[model samples]
Target: MATTPHAFETLKLTGLGRSFGGHAALAGLDLTIRAGEFIALLGPSGCGKSTALNCLAGLLPLTHGTITMDEKRIDTLSPEQRGFGMVFQNYALFPHMSVERNIAFGLQMRKVSRSETKRRVTEAIALVKLEAHAKKLPGQLSGGQQQRVAIARAIVLEPSLVLMDEPLSNLDAKLRLDMRTEIRRLHQSLGLTTIYVTHDQEEALSMADRLVVLREGRVQQVGTPEELHTAPVNWHVADFMGYRNLLDVTVTESGAEGVLVSNEDLHIRGTAVGGVTPGGAARLAIRPEDLRIASSEDTGDGLIVAEVAVVEYHGREFSVGATAKSGTTLYVRSELAPQPGDKVRLRVDPARALVFAADLDAAGEPVAQTALAGEAAT
Candidate 1:
């Protein structure tokens, strides 16, 4: 009896990049996927998440860097030789082929025995629970069913790694949830090393064991959903990962006694950024859920007196929008319904807040705004 190798052993991408017409798409994309780890590549549109995936799949040529699977560099390998299973956003199902035929195609191409292909096809159809749809063509299947068939076809080869690019984007909300659960079930059962690319924050958070968040052809943050949710390292990440209270703040005082200033009214009593001078631009960020509307009687470690401007109610909780006395917009989330024009104090847990230096370009935005205003008045 032969033992099986790990799903993926230390897959690495070192200083990877790709460029088109002098515009770099993927740059310095260094990533390490542990054996059997499911990692989601996440970002907004044009951030190169898909480009990185294509690089891994060998569908696109790399302009720089190296890729290694188990320390055996496969940067020169073709897609078929690399043995990566890819499920594209569009499903990529062959319209004329039946589901079973699609599942068996890879095995047939690899010249597996006919009887073995039949057995594997049965198993694959059973895995996706598409036994009834086995006789149906891709054209006859629903979007969700077609996606399942695509997944089955990809995995039937028993490839070491699977790549999915926004595979659920075409499905309805209910089917998306179902597919999410199905994919998780498949991941848990098969333990296939999977690299998923998606722009949906909720999908990535719900499905991935960890995620690589990218921006501007570079990695911004990489962490599990909980880690990213609780403690993103910087302002771009904080804002991208649903941190609503990411405010531009500067240190008014420093040393053992540090006071952080935002707009004006909210004076945070803490060393906002260690090893940072008072004059430098910085950002303070927190999730909207972490902030609270303090009652008139409440006194807390992190309270910013504010007024309710808008109230949006969800069945489980409420999303509150407010303005500070300093004119900074504040967002608070709670179960209570706050009416328009209601004055409220909000508490921000300082320890839970994340701060980082402002990007030079972003830091200059206010000055540009002021200049535009001056120009408009003149």
Candidate 2:
């Protein structure tokens, strides 16, 4: 596939919001997308990622705010008038139509010349490497093939912006991985500006140039994959970004170097974030891979002594579940296999640990003091 020309210089969303029956599904979404950039909307279900995609696609009307491309407002336009391509999770292909016909449908609807439509469709089919399957009906093709047809259909129109709403959700795990590569390749080869919606953190981190994490219809954080993974803005974002161990602790010391937090029987130092204050309650987040069994004679300042409850082999390493003396459960990945009932000293580098202000309830009390064991806080 050859690189297509760049589209608009910038697409801006100002206070972009959508509501359903007085309940806001997306609100105050302010973002500026540069042309030819791949952006992913990442979050768990009901986080308004899909709502934001739909609003961008013109499938849903905005409750408030505006969307503009290169300073030209487009929120008031119709879906067709917006001239953006959309690929849905279900593929949304016409079962009765052949792959070629499906790919040609949009061009046909636009009243493109017969010769031009056929040529564009041929190019699209080749671009997706589906020339052999072009004559096959949607039901006759595999899930991955059907998804390629959907992609071909969208790209044939040469739309400036492409919107995808969980497009790989229906595929099998292997197919999802394969399609991730395929979609990324096409986006790059086409020089497309894409906004993708997905709940999968790995998918977003792997494919997008930048990620926008949403929660409860609000933007939580927006940054590159490395930025979010290395330094999540809050505990919630940390939990979503694969920081599987989140423990409640009280900050004993805070400084430019970081913060030292402690719970009964456990004291750890971690990078302070979200304005953690000394003597205040905080949440400590550590990724499982970063937490490992400490070597003998390698006594560390933040050593956590735990009794291994289980150890499962993960081919490359062992996934260990342990209970600290403080009663907090911890998940760690280690090269050394520690059997159940074995006592181990776990350690995490201060750079790998993150501490944030504790989430507070409406009553100003710390919310859910228990740790999130091998799972994100939801």
Candidate 3:
């Protein structure tokens, strides 16, 4: 299917800030969206991802800063004037209207000619593979099919950009996966620049070209999926990215070998990429998969001696919970199952761990923001 050619100007956001009741919901955000790139706004609930999306859609007004597409200012424009397509979690289809009519609603609102609207709507239904159900009402279709109608509605206008807010959240697991593929396929075929807001890490990581992680109304980190997964800026992001263990330690040494960290009963050398001065407080972040368990007889240098406290089998592997001599709990995943009440030594490769300096935010708490700033400084 052919789409109308777009002007293809980059969308630029600068110092985007939004507040309600004098409380900041999004603050000082800067981003550049390439003409055809897919970006995800990812974070936990209340992390301002939805707020950012609404600001872009002009559904909500920005408290400060500017949004631009090429040379025109867009932050001040109404939602319709922006001419960007939007899909919401609710499907938002008119129950009384047929799929084809729903898809034609936007074009009709814009005073497009009836022939042009019918032509675009037909292409859109085919684009989403909903041609067979074009005359059916939304209620008669399956959840996934209804969502396709919503997507068809959005794309029938051939808007310059597309914004989606948790569009697949209502679907079942299998359906969600199927729709993810469908969305990616549509993005590629249409060459649409898209900004997707989702709390699910897998959705963001799998679908977006780049992801922006938000926290407490601030930008925490922005990078590709592999970059964020392999090397998170700090403990917060590491935790969000599925790093199961984050241990508090003091930096004993920092050099080419790595950042050596030591606690009461643990010593680990992790990646030294983030800032960590020797003799300073730091945090060591490692995934459960990276931690291995060995018997006392097989112990090596720098092994963490701990007592197995719990064991859970997960088909292919065992998730072992162990307690160190210092009473700190650690989790490990191993193919070799271990029984509870067994003594074990934990081992982690230095290259598989990440260490970050202990930096706190204004509330006197450690956060991802400082970790990103520390990395930037390095």
Candidate 4:
């Protein structure tokens, strides 16, 4: 297996997978990441995003795969020999070492001269805007500072690719947003090939050049942020993208422009742009913001009327939930601030709606990983 030297070409994975006993962390997954690309590997916990990253980073041996860098194979190389820098979620800096020393450790391991190490350390500290804190130990720095130190150390080696595994998980919300901007700026200024592993939707959508949505050891969809948002391949992705009003409907024909929905009683017209099969079990997914509320309205060609059951208020928005006349539960986002027990009609735009087949186990179940996100302080 030969190694390639730069990130300006495609890094390919063919038949990549890992299996332990009867379970597979990743299975038969293939992807091609181009040089200088910034990709976010996004999925729920235990969904194989990390497993794929470990395989690509050479930290985990493949059960059956070939990794190619610029068309040359490099699957057998050790992690260090793969020439990729990594920033782990824990900011894995040496606790006793100063920020500058932590940044210089990789160069020191490679037997760089003391003078060169010092030069690189200086450059990295400047790049991360932590020159003033270079003398502090990991214990003495804030979580964001430590994360930046870890990032500086990773880039100080000038590796062709960088891997960040939930690097901002430890920071507070405000700090995470600040670091997000910083990382995006740094990636832009440097043009390094970066693979960011994250479960946070906003982080992935706001920062990534593209997204690779994974699920249960399979690649669900790969595309730009907008593409995934506007046209998800299935119900899981639509739900994940915040389309909470997913109601059952039926398509009468391929050429038909709308759908017939309800408990087989009501018929509603919606977009048929998603290549749905006629007379098939179809789900209409619409974003909460795409739905509107009214006190009175009649039967129409492009509207869904439901009775409000609950209304929750936040500072900037209100979330309303109701069961439509068709017995389908729906949630909508509104600024009007309706209250529970209020009788109101809901209207959702057809253009913003999505159609998908049901995948109950894969996409319908609520992920328990929300608890893990809350454990970031530990």
Any residue pairs clashing in model 1, and if so which? Answer: none
Q: Which residue runs of candidate 2 sit more than 4 Å off their true CA positions?
A: 369-378
lDDT of 3 by residue, 223-273 (tens): 999999887886767867877787878889878888789989887778865
Please tell me which predicted candidate would have the highest TM-score against the true structure. 2
Against the true structure, candidate 2 reaches a TM-score of 0.95
Looking at candidate 4, the ten consecutive residues that score lowest on lDDT are: 369-378
User: Candidate 4: where is the Cα deviation over 4 Å?
Assistant: 1-8, 249-255, 264-266, 273-275, 295-303, 309-316, 323-329, 360-378
Candidate whose lDDT is highest: 2
lDDT of 2 by residue, 1-378 (tens): 346667689999999999999988999999999999999999878889999998998899999999998899999999999989999999999999999999989999999999999889999999999999889999999999999999999889999999999999999999999999999999988899999999999999999999999988999999999999998999889978999998888999987778999998578888988787888888899999999898899885889999999889999998999998877789999888888999888899898998889877778778774433222334
**Quality of model 4 by C-alpha lDDT:** 0.79
Backbone clash pairs for candidate 2 read none
Q: Could you give the candidate ranking by lDDT, starting with the highest?
A: 2, 3, 1, 4
Order by TM-score, highest first: 2, 3, 1, 4
- For residues 281-361, what per-residue lDDT tens digits would candidate 4 score against the true structure? 677778888877754645565555566788888678888887766666688888877767676666656567666654324
Clashing pairs in 4: 7-35
